[model samples]
Target: MSSERPKLPIEAVELYNEFIHGGMSRRAFMTRVQGLAVAGLGATAVIEALMPNYALGQQISKTDDRIKTSYETIPSPKGNGTIKGYFVRPVSADSRSEKPSKLPGILVVHENRGLNPHIEDIARRVALSNFMAFAPDGLTSQGGFPGDDYKGGLLFNKIDKAKMMEDMQAAAEWLKARPDCTGKIGVTGFCYGGSVSNNLAARMGADLAAAVPFYGGVPPDAEIPKIKAAVLVHHGELDKNAAASYPAYDKALTAAGVAHEGYIYPNAVHGFNCDATPERYNKAAADLAWGRTIDWFNKYTRA
Candidate 1:
């Protein structure tokens, strides 16, 4: 968890990213790697090396008093049962009862690794911006996000995909109906979460006022027509698998006459906005994307 971390060669990092992201199979990457073999590690070692330890990836501490936090069991009507989530609202939002001060709600969806510290911190950041941020643990029934990223990934793999969407829908509705909220909602997701945000926009229709999907896959062309929200997208050009659909999604949104903007950030790869993974973090791009996301939310949800 220390700042003094092990450094991996660029090639090794690339291969690990490819395998971790399903771009390549474990066997395929093991066969192509020339470095891990020299270190006397097999495929297992390569996987261990890429696993994230949550303690080291802190951008915002959990104890930060600027925001009020709650661990809640929200209704998950489409899931097997209720799902737990980490919710945050500005401390000011909590203390104020004025009608004009009612904040908009933002659903922060987690990636395949479930609701880890990074996503929790993201929710806090959104709270600091004065929105109610509810980040659900999609793997809640599977015991939520394991402290280690790899374990969470394993848990996520066993989940019911359809139920996950249902739970997400429930979370959105719960936030919209909250006492402190203004009934306007925006959703943002990263990686797998981003893909859901894209699909959720269409699924939520007029309920979702805005969506910001970062480095996520695009929804089907047919789904694009159902999206009533304004969308702001960010992706890393180097993440070819996710980037390949950019054009198709662009054309679909344009054809559907949706108000949207998409960007493929130069020199950034998938998860660039996730500062937790230093290997993929791109500060300039992350800053730009965050700004655009905030502006997008303001235009559609707040303003």
Candidate 2:
């Protein structure tokens, strides 16, 4: 029969120190600490640093108090076809006073799930942060409503990449038309959206002040050299889905001679910034990344 036993919080460290001091043989110590979690506890602590606290999972309460803004469905001639986007800008008295007279704009993209709550919330959050953020319905032919279930599964399979770019171009045109907009813009995205941001910065040249891709797949090897904007790429080191190419991406960015910042959180898995995924959420890393994003935009897009 196996019995489960718990060890003191600091016992693991003491056992290692005892080994070093020759007070106990390594074999004897290993047997005694086998089920004591000497290694598992340490691994969990390290994971906690790189990942979000399971305790804080309850702290995130959803609310509809997010800032509101206007959006227009428009046609595009740039890529595949017509593209529609949800646009957000500052509205409150405090925002008008503290924000720049002419603010820069941001293009927010959606994940494979299509234009949903998380994507919309991101756009609203960007507006709240004082920049004009536009989240284009990445799937237009499929559907245009926020949070609506779409017919197609993956965006690339249904929507042509070229057409998506054209649609994005139309959305950018809309932002440029705004009187308060400064004409400088940036692109950022999560998951599949991140991949688009990377590819766009390489494919689309004009008006991009910065590019921030979070846990996105990278573009082709040849496309690496085409990147034009200052890039900030975030990834999960432990992300099985995205980490395979992380090293190659780092090399590509370095070889391309682009000014970029690459962050790979040690134990973080895919979608660390996503509040929906309890396993992948990392509050500390998310906040830090967000702060960096704000500073990056401020540096590139400030009026």
Candidate 3:
């Protein structure tokens, strides 16, 4: 066997600092960062561009407040002519049982994997957090499933952003009609879904109360000002995928005077919340981000 060994600990940091000073390629930085495996910090610190305040110092009380989730199909002018979606709502706190049925609502877009178990689980999670969460498969026509290939990925490739927004608009209208739901609405998602969230908020006009995108591609600068909701953005510091675009998006939001919070998880990579991908999963970061998302919606949508 060859006698090559890994780079030394001190040497690694020195190399990283050199790359930082020289403004070296992101690929080189990521490769070096992942290999170092820095102590106490995990691999995340190496790739994260900067450190975020890790102040999950408060205790989360387990309360009796409960929410329920379900699936429905609504008519829309899309590829399949029907928009299939999933939603979560509060069973007890719902206004329908009383006189007014308005409740804060949320639309969750899915990653490239389409409408899979993980996406449904996210809906349930959002319900538990007290918002009416709805997830519609942006690519329902053509083939079906998002996680697997149908008709050689052509169906997913044909996803039209404008139509997806229309489908979501229908879903929001459906919520508006529900006596158990409030009219206020927000949108959020991860990866391809996150990018959709950005585009959707801009297209949905002024009604959206909030928007949260996690590691998704950003839309153009002109589109940022059209976003009416307060936005919360999550990015992986070392992520090779979407890092280059997020800073520009953040700058645009700031310039537009939009209320927004953006966090870049250190040493994290793409798919940090995906437990199935252990290689990319970072429990601490995912948990923190989830709590923040809940807190954000609660602040805006509380009755």
**TM-score per candidate, chains pooled:** 0.88, 0.71, 0.71
> Which of 1 and 3 is ahead in TM-score?
1
- Candidate 1's residue-wise lDDT over 214-277, tens digit each? 9888887778999999998889987787888888898899998889999999988778887777
Worst 10 residues of 1 by lDDT: 34-43
For model 2, state the Cα shift of residue 103 in Å: 0.7
Against the true structure, whose TM-score is highest?
1
Candidate 2: tens digits of C-alpha lDDT, residues 1-303: 535423333344444334323456546756655646543355444223333232343332233344446666777766646776777776666455755367789989876656666666677777777788889886776666434222223333566767776676677667766677888888889877898788878876555778899988898898888887888988877665576777788888889888788888776656767764444566788878888988888887774
Q: For model 2, what is the alpha-carbon lDDT of residue 102?
A: 70
**What are the per-model numbers of colliding residue pairs?**
0, 4, 8
User: What lDDT is obtained when candidate 3 is compared to the true structure?
Assistant: 0.66
Off by over 4 Å in 1: 1-10, 22-50, 53-56, 93-100
Error of 2 at 151 (Å): 5.5
Q: After superposition, how far is residue 139 of candidate 3 from its true place, in Å?
A: 2.6
For model 3, how does the per-residue alpha-carbon lDDT over 1-303 read when each residue is reduced to its tens digit? 756433235444445434423345557766767776655454555444221111221122123246555578878864357788877665563334556445678888876546765666677677766677788876765445534422213455576756766776676666656665667777789877788778777776677777788888777778888987788888877675576677778889899888888898887666676554344567888898888988888876563
Q: Give Cα distance to truth, residue 171, candidate 1, Å.
A: 0.7
Give the TM-score (vs. native) of candidate 1: 0.88
Instruction: Report residue 253 deviation for candidate 3 (angstroms).
Output: 0.8
